[model samples]
Every structure is written in C-alpha cells, then in structure tokens.
Target chain A: MAFQILLNIAIAFIWMLLKNNFTGVEFAIGYIVGLLLLFVLRRFLNFDFYFRRVIAVFKLIVLFIYKLILANIDVIKIVLSPKLNIKPGIIAVPTKLKTEWEVTLLSCLISLTPGTLSMNFSEDGKTIYVHAIHVPDKNEAIKEIHNSFEKAILEVTK
Target chain B: MTEIVVSILILLGGAFSILGSIGIVRFPDVYGRLHAATKSATLGVICIIIGTFLYFLLVQELFIGKLLLTILFVFMTAPVVGFMVSKSAYNVGVKLWDQSIQDDLGKAIKKAEKKARQ
Candidate 1:
C-alpha cells in the first residue's frame, strides 16, 4: 500500500516536471494520468493498487452511514413507543474474519449499527458476543449481522 | 438559506442527543443502555459536526478540515469506548436484565469448559 502511494506520488511529480505545470489542477491531472498508467501496469505489479482498497473503504463508509441512519430511526421508534416490547439478549455471532484489526472493525460496526452492541469476543476471535435489544430469532439476528456488517467488512479487509 | 439548514441540523442533533440520554436512563441493563448511548450519540455528534462544517464553508467562507477529521475520529472511537465499558462490566459480573431472552456467551463459555474438562 505504501509503495503504491509513493509510486503514484512519484509518477505525479514526474508528470509535473515533464509538463512544467506545477499547479494543483495540473498535479491532479498528473495524478489521474499516473492512476491510469498504474491501472494498465497493475498485472505486472505483485500487489493490488491501493486505490481499490480505498474505494472499498469508501463504500464501507457509505454503507455504514446508511445503516447508522436506519439504526437511529429504529432506536428512536423503540424509545418513543408506549411500551418497551423488546427481547434483549446476548447472542454468539460467529465471524470468518481472521485478523485482529478486521475483527475489531467488525465489532465496532456491530456496536454502532442498529439494535446490537458487541459485548465480547470468543478466545479464538471467530465469534463475537453481541447484545441485541430485539432478538426475535437468534438465527435471524445472526444472519443480519453476517449479511450487513460482516459482509461489508470482508470486502474491505479481504 | 444556509442559516436555516444549519439550524435544522443543529436542532436534529440536539434531539438525537436528548433521545440518547433518555435511552440511557430508560434501558434496563448495561448492554441495552450501551445500544442507546453509543450509536445515537455518535450520530448526534456527526450531525453537529457536519452542521458546523457546512456553516463555516457556506456562511463564513472558511473550510476547516479539522471538523471533518473530528467527525471521523468520533465515529471510529465512540463505539470502541462503549465496547470497552460493556466488556469490563461483563467481566465484573454485572448481571444481564432478568427479562433478557438469551445468553449465548454463557453457553459458549460452558461449552468451552466442558471441552477443557474432557
């Protein structure tokens, strides 16, 4: 990732030097040119381009924001309702995430998303214990976690 | 105008923050309260920060990058803090609400212990 960024920067500088146009717009054009050049040469490179990961991260952020809004509305409805009709519980949510950072991210997303708070992780890190405010069905809750946050996380990290 | 938009954002943020506080008070258990506190509060903070950012950029003609940075920082850290607090509370044996429907973690722990015994 660092190498990809440094190479892109180097390419941008080389383009500026060649064009003798050192303005921000020129630099941006140079960067795009470099980005395209790198795209063409990606097969020769051992590692993937950094921007793909960046784009995935951006998508994850957008998805997170969407989920955040939905979650807040759900919580607001629950809180404002006449009665608290919730079946709060802690459920074991198994994850396929391997790295600690990915698991931590998954946990954070789970906590920040609707109806769930990540309480603990299994010793193997393959499972997260999530406390959900409304667990109508354990399987359904698990599936929702797997479908939304876990899937988005897998895309970013893997 | 920009003023109206900013005011709406700030008001929405305040409402969410107030709701979060109410949630914390009304929730039955630590975990349930955390569900209220972190998520709503993070969104509340983000709303306020974006309002500030928009106000500066549109009304004052000043673009402060730090406001954006602050939102990102808060969004990332708030849940971690909640997670830590809940985990510590669990470790301290703070009980789950009696009405809670399940405790899968306890089951997992027991299953692990049985394996160790075998």
Candidate 2:
C-alpha cells in the first residue's frame, strides 16, 4: 500500500514537472495517468495486491460513509422529536484486533458515526467502550457493529 | 456544467451546517450537543471544504495542496476533539438525560473501583 502511494506521488511529481502545471486538477489527472501506467505495467510489477487493497479501502470508505449518513439522519430525527426518546448507554465490545493502530482506527470510525462515540479501550486492549445514543437492543447493536464496521475495517487493514 | 454541480454541493453543505447549528441550539443535554457538533458539523465542514476544493479544481484551474490538506486536517481532528470533549464531560460526571435507559459505564466504573479498593 505504501509503495503504491509513493509510486502515485512520484508519478504526480513527474507529471507536474512535465506539464509545468502544479495545480490540484493537474495532480489529479496525473494520479489517473499514474494509475493507468501502473495498470499497463501490472504484469511485470505484480501490482494485483495493491489494486485489490485499494479497491477494498474504497469499498470500506463507501460503506462507512453510507452508515454515517444513516446515523446522522437518525440523530436529527431524535433531536427534532417532540420528546427526547433516546436510550443512551455505553457498550463493551470485545475485539479481535490485536494491534494499536487497528484499535485506534476502529475507535476513530466509531466516534465519527452519528449517535455513537468510542469512549476508551480496556486496559487489556481486548475490549473497547463505546457510547451510543439510541441502542434499544444491546446485543443487536453489537452484532451490527461487528458485522459492518469491524469486519470492513479488518478487511481493509489486513 | 461544473459550476452548477459545485453550486449545488455548496448549497447542500451550507444547509447541513445550518442544520448542525440548529441541532446545537435545539438539543437538550451535553451529549446531545456533542452528537450534533461532532457528526453533523464534521460532515457539514467536510462537504463545504470538498465543494470549495472542487470549485478551485474545475473553475479556478489551480491545483491546491493546501485545500486537500485542510480537508484532511478537519476530518482527522474534528472527531478526536469531539471525543476529548465528551470524555472530559463524562469523567466530570455530566449526567445523561433523565430518561436514559442504561448505565454500562457507571457499572464498569463501580466494578473497577471495587477491585481497586480490595
């Protein structure tokens, strides 16, 4: 992943030097051009892993964004309602992720989603404490988190 | 054609920002307000930044590293700042809404304290 990113950046630099247009659009075009070049050279470079990882990351981002919008709408609805009908609570979620970076990314993802906040990790690092605004069924909510965010994060990061 | 799209995006971003501010004004408690600011406000800011960047990318014809950096900075910092604020509030014992249904954290704290005292 890092190598591919570095390659993309190097291509952009070369493009800027050639076009003499160091603007954002030019850089973006350069990125596309770089991607194409990479595609053409894939057989020699064996860039299949990089391509698959990039696509997986994009899919994970899209899924997270979709959930974020849905969660935001839910928060807006709760706030605008005549009565405050929220059932706020903290949830202890045990995680299979063993690395600090993975746990940090998971926490960031959780906190960004509307109506949910990632509080802290247990000292042992095996569990995270998340606070959510509208959890009716704790087990179900945990299941959904595991199925969507956790799984997608692991898929992309791994 | 690009102008029209950027304009609409800018409008949508402005509207979300307004809604987020309204959420801040309308919410009952600190947690509610945190929800409004962190989620809606972050999205609103991201949208506006993205729209502005698009405008520059297309109409202005200047590729700006700063614009992209600004968006990335906001995306990374906003949620962490929000998390810090909420964590401080919770640690200081800012009460949840009276109608809140659960207290898993409170329970956990109590258990931790008991373990410490033993």
- TM-score for chain B of all predictions: 0.94, 0.94
Q: What is the TM-score of each candidate against the true structure?
A: 0.91, 0.82
Scored against the true structure, residue A124 in model 1 reaches a CA lDDT of 83
Which candidate number maximizes TM-score? 1
Screening candidate 2 with a backbone cut-off below 3 angstroms (N, C-alpha, C), the clashing residue pairs are A23-B63, A24-B63
Alpha-carbon runs more than 4 Å astray in model 2: A1-48
**Which candidate ranks first by DockQ, i.e. highest?**
1
Worst 10 residues of 2 chain B by lDDT: B97-106
For candidate 1, write residues B1-118 as lDDT tens digits.
Answer: 9999999999999999999989998888888888888988778878998999999999899999999999889988888898899989987889999989889988987898999999
Deviation in angstroms for B79 in model 2? 1.6
Residue lDDT tens for model 2, B1-118: 9889888888877877887888898876787777888888778878888888888999989888897899889888876887788778889999887867787777888999999999
Q: Model 1 Cα displacement at A44 (Å)?
A: 5.9
i-RMSD of all predictions? 0.8, 1.5
> What are the fnat scores of the candidates, in the order listed?
0.83, 0.60
